[model samples]
Target: MTTDSLILPIALPLLGALLATALPRIAPLLGVLTAALTAMSGLWLTGLVWVSGDLSIVLGGWGLPLGIGLSADGLSAALLAMSSLVGLGISVYALGYFSGSERGLHFWPLWLLLWTALNGVFLAADLFNLYVMLELLGLSAAALGALTGSRDAVSANLRYLLVGLLGSITYLLGVALIYTAYGTLDIGLLSERVEPSALVSTSLVLMTAGLALKAALFPLHFWLPPAHANAPAPVSAALSALVVKAAFYLILRLWTDLFATITDAGAAFILGALGAGAILWGSWRALRAERLKLLAAYSTVAQIGYLFLFFPLLQALPPGPARDDLFAACVLMAVTHGFAKAGFFLAAGLVQKKAGHDRIDELGGAAQSMPATTFSIALAGSALIGLPPSGSFIAKWVLMQSALETGQWWWLIVIALGTLLAAAYIFRVLSRAFGQEPTPQCFITDARAEIPALLLALASVALLGLAAGPIWSLLGFEGVQI
Candidate 1:
């Protein structure tokens, strides 16, 4: 299929979101079906690219230096696949997940809008276009974040909104810088044109800082934990799994296309330093959190740190060596983390719903009764903790080797320590839920609620040790070092 062929994947949800405003009664069914179709289409698109090389679709008839465009290489497609599947999972989870809420009328529309923004963010090709999509994504996410209407939810959403705007403004300034310097905003065009001038350096800083803030990278992540924990379960899963990733994807895209040309020693150290800080700070907070949702939310801050740490990993290229394997590791980590974190949030949400509170001390032996959900949490936790044979384990292995190869061994230490932190927080929750305290469930979230989290968890586990050929092949991009 042509790249344009999958345009419907982006269009369908937006259409549904619009339709939902008028037909809230049918919004749940429509949203669920649209998500399923989008995921299926994404799978089909990925298979198409894998067998037939990559695809790009220019908006209208415009080419790269002129009008906006959309492109899909293996990396973009892989993330698209993640969004597709995760979106469907969130949608289904939303169905039952919303039943408990008295606000389904508002939930369905915002939820569908979020799906649209996610797909749009993944598909965007031009720098300016990405800004627009990210802005749309930001507004919808903030609106969705505030939907729960609790004091915490409102407070968190307000913080999230302000922080998101700050990031957006910074990113836009960077976009303007790029346009002024090279007169091109298309990534492919910028790739061919960018040079190591003051303008390029400033733009890189603005863009990276903006994306880091949006992705909740450490030091700039103050808004993430409360924002995520205060939202409804499905919403939290979507925010943690997909929304934070939008900014990370932007950073990855910018790195590959523009900054790759200016790759040098100082920038590498600075990015790596931030990544190290995020790993330590987020993990420390997660360890101290007394509640499950808060713990998972903080863990997201830490996991996001792992994504930025890839900056150092890719930088480890021996001046002129292949960065393909390293870049692949970064993509795999982000994708794997997407599934693992989503599953973790969904499972946490389940625990909170059933227990009526997410406090760790009160969650006594509920896991035995909710065996399947508990098991899902454990399996997902395995991936998060980077246990052997999980996707995250392979990501860590690749990262460790890359760090060792380049002699930047401090990041390796961070990975090892962060993994242990991941394990500690996960174990804290699981161990408490092991025996039979027989707390009567304050509420029972349905099995439909359970399946999305479980599928995403299974996906996280299955990602580990995935046949190398598929992922390796997906790393293909034209005329790039990695």
Candidate 2:
């Protein structure tokens, strides 16, 4: 593939958003077609990255400091592929969920806009471009989250919008500081020029702090649960599964890639501590949540905490196979959660629609009435709990192994506690699936809606679980054993 192919993933959805906005009468058809094409382009780019090493392009034939650059390595390509797959699933689910509604008209454009931002983030090669993409992402996300128009949805998303703006402004301040200290906004240039100085340290701290808030890490995660729980189903899926993950991806990039020289074990430890707190606190809240969607939202907070746990371990290990394994495990955990959580939210939305409410206590007969959705939930919940033959299981196993190898055995206890809590919350919902109601005659009530959930959930278990070796290859560690 040529370097120009890099722009297709970002451009297709952008053009689709504009077309969708102009032609609302055919918005759904345009949205789905655009989503399919974007997914194809993303996968094609990922394939090129896998075959070659990395790809970079400066738009409009301009060089650094004057041109906008887009680059794709294993990290960005993996995320691009994840976003494409999960995004397509969400688009398909939205088709049946929003049938014959005016909200569908508005949803297509905003959703495509969000997709554009997501792809831009993964491909951006400059810090200023990242800020611009992040701003667009936050605006589209907040708007999509409030699409239901209920009082709660509006109130929660308003807070989300404000918090998101705060994060972007703080991040921009760091970008400005870096540009002042150095001479360029390109990450490649900045990385080469950055040195261990007060200005650089301050810039890293400000950027990490801002990104942690956006990623909903521990104490800064106060705004997440309500916003996710109150949004429409597809919106909720994208918010919890893809949106927050984007912020965390930026944090990982900064910590491991751009700012790797200056970052030390002490800073990594602090992040790991916050992650431990989030794991315990978020899981506990999820177990006690009364609403099903609220439970899933809290679970997302906890799952994000698990990703942070790897930072300390990664910092402790030197560059070798051990560190590579741990890093790959972290990515595997992230990709697994992307699929599992999206599937869980989609299935939960179906249950809510059928039951007319999402209360965990009153979902007995409503859950049993739809066998396919219930099964989807069961599969996804197993993955969430890190059950055997699931992607989370492999990731956590590698995590614990690295913890032991690095003499950070205390983290094993935190992982154990988090796993137990995850199981409790997931099982609590599954228990409600078994009721005295009569069995359904068929497995699937709606193929358009149910199949996407099932396929996504199965991917979490079967695709990522058994075929996890590909992840190591995708990350450019071909011979490493999982």
Candidate 3:
């Protein structure tokens, strides 16, 4: 039942993409239907995992060496659930968003394809298939980023495309090396067979670098801000909230599973150092950003740094309840940021549309006009700032606790500084909401668009944080360790 449920999330979106391209006029209806069905299927799979634990299936009944396999563990199920809910919200928002534009027709097909890719990445059990999913995801994302057709959007996304190609090539080379070494690409098989060698180490480096580029880690993130900022709001939301997470998921999977025996303190610390750089650099840039979307884009860089900061601490501890708690915390942070960032981008889009610009200073009046949008920003900003009761707050607390417990006190300093920087930039935007402007006739403008943004924002702080205990149980952990 769980394996059957997994196929629907991937298949429904592919069908929607074809239907949307063939029937552009009714694309919005098709998109909503796709989102509803896909989201339901994802939820069903998550429930099955909760009840039955990990599930795997090999396509065509050709088990092992010749078959494509799909698997859903607690981690995959959690991400799938986050993507489905957020995807559904974005689809509804897009319905009101693209109503009168030619780009609207282009959006549904490309977006659904992107959705298909996200699902594929989460459920794929083979390394080579993950590479295929990454390629499709990259192509669709680059195309979507260019939907605005502005000079900046086109040029930025072209660079994004080139970078994505380089990443894919590097990742594919690593996959080839792995297959040549072990004669198979199954992740579970690799975990049992992998042994430390120069070739294996080099392949690990190649795969990590490729995924880092895709995930926009630190120095490799040059293409992110421009591409994310210039895209349509829904596109921006999807890119930051869903697409990058897929790449990072692979990196985490490889490190924890296939390369676990080979991981060392030096390598983990190096990764954490890069994360520190991203935190300081990305936050400083976001503080100085003049435009709202660009600020949000830079914040994504900083938020990703927080995710990576979990690595060194994870490596420092032995496998136990403490380590498991940190692992679950990192996933919770990623999921929380998914919902928060999506809401932020959607609200930013509305602000840009109404005010005709997203300049932070000029947005004072625009921010104050729509109560719902402002409220959405406030909720999301709370999460971004790691304020109490937000999932990030809980995640960061666990992360810092681990850092301290492991005697790696330096990371705590990094977290503190990053938290301060996050607070500064988040409050910078929120402050504008108090500026004088004519009162809005209602808390919302188009309920279709604003409500989705509001609901997602609310979930980030409320549903994910206060109720996140189940994340451990869903991930198959013994109990809430923290």
Better of 2 and 3 by lDDT: 2
Could you tell which candidate, 1 or 2, scores higher by TM-score?
2
Model 1, position 233: C-alpha lDDT score: 85
lDDT of 2 at 371: 90
TM-score of 3: 0.90
Compute the lDDT for candidate 3.
Answer: 0.91
User: What 10-residue stretch in candidate 3 is worst by lDDT?
Assistant: 434-443
Q: Provide the lowest-lDDT 10-residue window in model 2.
A: 434-443
Model-by-model lDDT, in order? Answer: 0.82, 0.92, 0.91
Native RMSD of candidate 2 (Å): 9.5
**Can you write out model 1's per-residue Cα lDDT over 1-482, one digit (the tens) per residue?**
36676586677888878888888778777777777877887777788778777778887776567767877778878888898888888888888888755587688888878887787888777888788888888888888988978898998899898999999999999999989998988787788888889988899999989988999987899999999999988888899989999998888888766678886678867877887898888988998898888888988888888888878667658544447777887888888888988888888888888889888877787776688888878888898888878788888887887877788877877887798788888887787788566344333467889878877875665454332445554777343222
Rank the candidate models, highest lDDT first: 2, 3, 1
Cα RMSD to the true fold for all candidates: 10.0, 9.5, 9.7
Clashes of each: 2, 0, 0
lDDT of 3 at 138: 99
Q: What is the C-alpha lDDT profile of model 3 across 370-469, one tens digit per residue?
A: 8899889889999998999999999999998898799998887788778878888988787765677433434477999999999999789657865688
